[model samples]
Target: MASKYRRGFDITRDSLRVFTREPSLLLLPALSFLAVGSAFAVLAAILFQQGLVESVVTNDLYKYGALFCAIAISSSVATFFNAAVVHCAAQLFEGNSTSVRDGLAAAWRARRQIAVWAVVAATLGTVLYILDEKFGVVGSLTRAVFNLAWALLTYFIVPVIVLDQRRKLRDQLRRSGSLFRETWGESVSATLGVSFIFLLVALPGVALGVAGYFILDGVLAVGALVGGGGIVVTAIVGSQTASAIVRTALYRYATTGEQVGPFDGRDPDTVFPEN
Candidate 1:
């Protein structure tokens, strides 16, 4: 267990280094968030103009349906951007120079696949949300478990969409599941390491926000809030980018049995070594 955690931390540290080398990669997630936020704002405005917002808020069926569509749209946008980042990270692993333009182009090329997967993911997410909202504690627990399982199973979906565009969506999902099974231990470790790093990164911002509530006044307090919020956002985006890069590296190592410099140097055989 100790060895596993060490390896996970090492992999995450290396992943962060790779991200720092190309801070531009973090722009993908930032852009995705911006685009999705803009879209949702526009959507809300339209709904309000149409006087459907009241219905959506009051009607259970309409509410869930609207939530479903919103979640689906957000998921699709996120998947598209994530696929782009995966493409760029894969290029980096291959020693090829890539920019945001290259990543966007790659994502555009795989847009259809991303759309298909997004619908599947959105459907599952909507169902889970509905279950948790409508049912009692048991339903909420089930949704939580299923949500984690879904995340674990689809860890490599972005890489598959970026690297194996020819495969059908179901096939890609199956491949992701298989690859994840082989590297579940490492994946968990990497996730934990990333989460820990994120916590560390956000701690100062959190402290500032708390201190602002007590010590600062008016404009200074608002400045603290904005500054702290910016740091938290940066940390979130950085951690997410690192996680995606690590996922891409793991997928390449698992599929090609080749080490890609500092990103991946583990033995292919050891990926699923004999017990």
Candidate 2:
């Protein structure tokens, strides 16, 4: 049963294969989300520099409440889109020959449900923020609970909206929670498997990005001025690209039960040779 989240898809072989098959294709959906999410991140940075964050923090009795909420909401939207794209990418990664148009259309089809999920998530996130502010809990404690819930909820929305293709928003969200309990172990492994891949990519990318930026600075005085923004953006895109690929792999491994060993799958849209 699609709802039997316990028979979790095998991420070891198939997950990596998806990214290997179409390295370039993996980045599109994530980039789409990044385009929106990163814009907010950039805007937040600008506002912080302008003392907007400081002023808000100082004036409000619940200084960090709004800040936390905004960040949570932004991250929620980003993750939702990422999940949707992961579904689309999984289809393509499995040799489905689907166009980005079809992939995106599939996601768009579930936009209302996703939007609803995001709203629910945002509300819960805000409530948690309020609780933290009121209680003055440690930051680490707050983060662990928040991220764990987010991780658990990860496959719920994707499975409900994209794979299940349900029309009603409530049905999707409701089904997701139910689905999580069915195969809790497998569902979690799949997420962790993919998350590990993204983390693997992050380490090298950070080193390269930072090293590259400084190298450019050494050669060209005012390198940060001439190309700082572009370099930062490139680093971000690079990390997003890697993260997206791993996510696409996880989706395939989960949905299709296909194992994608390193370099073992067909390139996206590739024509197979006749035996």
Candidate 3:
């Protein structure tokens, strides 16, 4: 277990090196957040204008349907941006320079697949939300386990969607599942390593917030809170960027049997040793 953690941490470090070289990759995810938030805002505005907010809130069916629509919109926007990230990252690994515009263009090309996958994602998410709301703790536990499985199973979905010509969602998911089975260790470890490291990194921000509330005064406290919030947000974005890069690297290796860029010196065997 310790060895696995170390390998995962090493992969995260390598991903960070890739990130340092082209920090603009961060812009993609930042844009994703903005895009998703804007999508939800627009959705809310539409609901309000239609005077459906009350019905959505008061009726379970309407509520779930509205939730599904909202989730679908956010999912589509996020998937589009994630496709951009995967496209840009793949280009970087291929020894080619890529820009945000180029990445967005690539995602735009795959917009149909993104739309289909978004509906699938939104459906699953809505079901989980309903289960949690209906059954409490048991539902929450089931949702968590199912969510993790779904995440691992679809780990390579964005890369596949962005790079492959497959139109059907099943075909893309099958490819992703195949790649996950081939490199499950590295994939899981990379996720754990990144999550652990970022959790630790975000702790100081949490501490700052606490200190501001208890030890600091007035404007200083507000400043500390704002600074702390900024740090936390940055950490969240950094973690997302690092994870996407590592995923792209893993996908490239699984598909091409070659690791490039920051992955040049890493031994493939060690990274994905025979089980």
Candidate 4:
């Protein structure tokens, strides 16, 4: 356990170092969030204007259907940006200079794969949502288990899609699952470290928001809200960028038997022990 934790910490620290070297990698998540938010806003406006929102809200079937569609759209946007980030991270690992524009271009080239993955993800998400809403404690527990499993299984899918454009979606999924199973320990450890760092970074923002609500009023409160929000956003972007870097590095090590950047000192076999 100690060894696992140490490995996770090293990987997380190295990921942050990569982010410090190329802070622009953070822009991918910000752009994705903005694009998806805008799309959802437009969708909401259209639904409201057409009275579709009211109908959907009143009917469970319509609500789930609309939710599924929204989730699919959002997933596509997320996959596109995630692929771009992975591409840029791969370039960085290779010691090649890259930019946000270059990353975006790579994602655009893999748009079809992104769309297909998005549909698959959205369907899964919709089913999980339905399970949680329709069933009681058992359903919620099942959804949670499935969600975690899904996350682990697909951890390397973005990198696969970014690196191997010619492979079909099913092939990528199979490869991702195989890779993750082989590196499950490292994957769990890395996730633990990232989650710990995220909590640490986000705590200040949460405190500030709570204090603002309790002690401040009017303009001061508004200022506090904005400040808190900005801090949270910064933490989120930083954590996400670090995560992408670490994930790409792990995937590269798994497939190529070559460690890059922060991974150079670590033994690839140890990092991804046999299942």
Candidate 5:
């Protein structure tokens, strides 16, 4: 267990190094956040203006439709930018320089695939959302299990879409799953490693927030909470970027059987053997 975590830490650190070199890759996740946030805001406005928010809360049809639409919009936008990130990361791995435009162009070229996957994702997400909303703990547990499997299987979908020639959704799904299966250990460890590292980084801020709640009051307490919350939020964003880099590197290795950039010289089997 310690070894696995160490491998994850090393891989995550290397990915962060690559991220620092091309800091602009951070823009993709930031744009994804803004785009998804804007979409949700517009969706909320539409629902409230139409007085359908109450209907959504009461009527299953309204609720599902609203949820589906919201999921579709957010998923589409996020997946689009994710593809862009993967494209740029691929360029970096391939010994080529990249820019945001290059990434956007690659994603734009695969817009149709991204749209189809977004709809599929939104449908699944809506179903899971309804189940959790209506079925209580059982639904939540079921969704959690299903989501984990879905995440593992679809891990490389964006990379495949942007970096491979497969166009059909099923074809893309198969490719993603295949790549994941081949590198399941390192792939999972790398992602979990990124999360664990960020969690550690965020813990201090969380501790501050808790400490402030107990020991401080008024504006000072609020300020402490805000400061701590800011740290956590920043860590979350940084982890997203770092996670993207790791995914790109993993995808490149799984597909090409060669590690590039910071990932080079690391033997996958020795570093994080499959369990």
Candidate 6:
């Protein structure tokens, strides 16, 4: 029997479905740990920069704007890695009992596509940031328009990354854009739904930090750090998971019912060796 929820969303691969089927249950703890580790690294690096981060935050708003370019590049890399983890979890969900190393290996196997796509995404983001920062004309509106556009148009990326072994990254992007046109409404809604839920969680954490600053300075500060970090990482991971989920749906939809594209003779599974 096909599970009713099966039609709702899938993790990018069958394996990811196992993990993200209960996203908050399995994802939050690991995401928090990873976020904590990454945050400490970032904080330490900033602190060692001779107060560069703090100074920029306080004094130069314009230069601080440039940080988005850096963030955009970093986010591209982070997205690629996020796919890796989601796939690993999906494999386990599929009862494969796969290891995380396999996930990393799968990513390395597709490094060329990964690198090229990341560069593309990062460049687009950096360009947007530059235009916004430098001109301030048609900046926020333009960026927001593109943001909403890209949000809907790029659903095929993950499926292309995992399934279409023959298609290059650029080709897959084109193919997916056209393919998902039929379900464009769901695509937009899902992305916006996740974004709204994220803001709901995040805004409260920020408010708590501000309110607690006076009463319980140290504890609240720590709370803010942990909560803020968790929210950020969860949002990041949630996005990849959602992508994986939708990609899985599309893959199954294509294979079983639709004659949308030729079978690339791929299993759509990430294989790894025993560790």
For model 5, the superposed segments whose C-alpha errors exceed 4 Å read 1-3, 133-141, 205-218, 273-275
For each candidate in turn, the TM-score is 0.87, 0.62, 0.86, 0.88, 0.87, 0.64
Top model by TM-score, which number? Answer: 4
Expressed as tens digits, the lDDT of each residue in 217-256 for candidate 6 is: 6766778767766666665555555545545544544445
lDDT by residue for model 4 (1-275), tens: 56655565676678767756578777898998889889999988988898897789899888988898899988899889988888988888888888899999999999988988988998999999889988989889999999988898899888889896645877998989998987777666666777676777788888888878889999988888888877887777767777777778888877887777557787645653433
Question: How many clashing residue pairs, candidate 1?
Answer: 0
What TM-score does model 3 achieve against the real structure?
0.86
- Candidate 3: segments with Cα more than 4 A from true spot: 1-9, 19-21, 44-58, 136-138, 210-217, 268-275
Q: How many steric overlaps are in each model, in order?
A: 0, 8, 0, 0, 0, 9
lDDT tens digits, residue span 132-183, model 1: 9889898899999998888988888898888977559779879899999987
> Model 6, which residues run further than 4 Å from truth?
1-17, 20-69, 89-97, 224-243, 258-275
Clashes of 6: 9
Give per-residue lDDT, candidate 6, residue 130: 62
Candidate 5 structure quality by residue, lDDT tens digits, 97-173: 88888888888999999899889999999999889989999999999999999999999888888888688999999
Q: Kindly provide the TM-score of model 2 when superposed on the true structure, using C-alpha atoms.
A: 0.62
| lDDT of candidate model 6 versus the reference | 0.54
Every candidate's lDDT: 0.80, 0.54, 0.84, 0.81, 0.84, 0.54
**What tens digits encode model 2's per-residue C-alpha lDDT throughout 85-137?**
56655565566655456656667776777677666666666666666666666
Worst 10 residues of 1 by lDDT: 266-275
Predicted structure 4, TM vs. truth: 0.88
lDDT of 3 by residue, 1-275 (tens): 66655666677677777756577767988888887778888888998999999999899998999889988988898788888888888887877888889999999999999999989998999999999999999999999999999998899998899887689998999999999999887677667778887887789999999989899999999999998887887787778777888888888888888876435778655663433
Error of 1 at 194 (Å): 1.1
